[model samples]
Target: MYTLAVCAEMVFRDLPIEERARRLHDAGFQVEIWDWTRHDLAALERTGAVFSSMTGYIRGSLTDEDDAAELLRTAEESVKAAALLGCPRLNLHGTGLDGRGLPVDPVAGEATGPMWIAAHRTLGRVAELGESAGVVFTLENLNTAVDHPGVPFAKAADTLALVAAVNRPGLKMNLDLYHAQIGEGNLIELVRRAHGLGLIGEIQVADVPGRCEPGTGEIAYPAVARALADLGYDGTVAMEAWASGDDDLALDRFRTAFTV
Candidate 1:
């Protein structure tokens, strides 16, 4: 069975981060978060929620040499925080994103040849760090069309290419279906290809039109869930979505969508 988790940062807006995590825990879901640097790790640990993943870098970009150094340094720090939270996976992007989900230094379009080479080199070092720290680092896909514009390698195909090229167990792709829908539709095949290549680390979901829980928008999530089950993907299927109305109801809808 797929282990269902929820991003605490997206739901239960009325509560504190720890409280949000606790609520998810009590509701029978694992928790996910972003930017561990901004949160009180100890307080979150006290909530007794099982953390599935969190943002893996504080400040770094894979675009240049100096930025890559910063990325590796902060990634090392992030590993420590992940250990404290007992989180098994850490999430990364092509560049460091600001609080608003915009890349700090956004790229205009597709990556150049040199940029691709640098990203591959930088991710090799990141894999070594993850290997040493006993955690997996996942590069998540983003939809430049909506939430994250100007972020290079924001497509699932690009992310899969990078992870598959590196071909290390320590590194894998965070196959986010919500972004894939906007950036590239045909999600069932996307999941098939990514998992078929043994490159996926996690799967995140939210509805299109609105970044809310399943059933509120166009995605036939139950079909996606059936596809996952058919593929024997027993990994995490997470709700990285906001509450359409009531938080608990949204969670229920998410659970229903993936309960194949």
Candidate 2:
């Protein structure tokens, strides 16, 4: 089944978290929580949304054994928490390239060699832990630093490389279109590559220039959506957009784009 998820950061800011989740469920969307700190698994159980792991706030990359162990513990807990909420996947961001929030040079930045190595090592442990907990761990590419300041792995190639390095079944790509539009020029080509590598697990979308609803921006969303459909991608095609101070208007725009 093709699934829909609303990034929690966009929808749950003003409302109670549970209420946000309930609304998503009512609107026919499965919820994907982002950078969420307040709600727990018990709360997720009450609401129908699936919980994906939020990263970047946790620490550095998942590549170091010691650091990986710590993340394993956290992932284990998140898995248990998500299980309570009946979620099947936990998503993460790669490590930050620089502490100063500069765009990472793909070839030389800390997030490149050692950091990438560390992420592989870290996620290897995460994969083992996640298997036992029944949670699938996925890593997503953020928009280039100009958009996701201080984050690492902005391009699709970097995320795919990290997944290949780990070579673990649990690790895969989150593949958000908003980020892809900013950094990648060819969506279909990249998606095809990810499929060939078995790296894509989840997908999301928003338009650029303002990260607003699909129809309101310049992205070729219809083509992108068609590409996703052609791939037989049945996972969540979440709308990761900002609300225009009017929740109904934002959701209406989302519904229109997705109704197909």
Candidate 3:
């Protein structure tokens, strides 16, 4: 059996977070807090989506620096927020090293060494802080080639490296298949590899190319599901897809993919 959560932004708009949680309950899906700005602990208590996790980092209102100390402070606050809301997980990323639009020559230690070092230091602090707060920090991959090209961890291997460098139990990888399929196409193989290494903390899915509902595109989700089951992966498989109309189509697609 696969537990499903929908990215909050994908299913619900900028309405009150409590109303969004109510709608998620009505739709029979858990809410994955994609937009942290809209989070409400009271709403979480009412909706029971507290068991769910989020995607992005806590922004300006949350933290204001890129150094290790700042990262630790931010992680502490995020854990406090999660615990206050009864959330157990908070998905995070290695930002700030994103060149934005600058040209980098790898030969000049341009984008690789500095970015990796910063990620290692910052996320290491996050790991330490999260450990004390009992909240897991899941680092996700971004599709840097086409979408979000400036992000540092744009591939699966890069995310894995960061986690390894942090070398903490509280820090884990968030393997969202949508980004994986687009950025690293060996879906089943990579899942198997991550499982083999005991690194994957969570997994998510959606069709590639367009990040739409499953079964509407080219990803072999059934095979991926089989691989996950084979690895005894019983974690939440959140849906991070776009819904042009009714999200029932998206839900149906997941039902087909997971066969639940």
RMSD of each: 0.6, 3.5, 4.2
Q: Which 10 consecutive residues of model 1 have the lowest summed lDDT?
A: 105-114
- Candidate 3: the clashing residue pairs are none
Candidate 3 deviant stretches above 4 angstroms = 12-16, 59-68, 96-110
Per-residue lDDT of 241 in model 3: 80
Candidate number with the higher TM-score (1 or 2): 1
Best by lDDT: 1
- As a TM-score, model 2 comes out at 0.85
lDDT per residue for candidate 3 within 135-239, as digits (tens), equals 778888767665565555657888887787787978889888888888879888888887787777778777877777788789989888887877788777888
TM-score of each: 0.99, 0.85, 0.85
Position 201, candidate 1: lDDT: 95
- Each model's C-alpha lDDT? 0.95, 0.68, 0.68
Backbone Cα, N, C clashes tallied per candidate: 0, 5, 0
- lDDT of candidate model 3 versus the reference: 0.68
lDDT of 1 by residue, 83-202 (tens): 999999999999999989999979997999888999999999999999989999999999999999999899988999999999998999999999999999999999999989989899
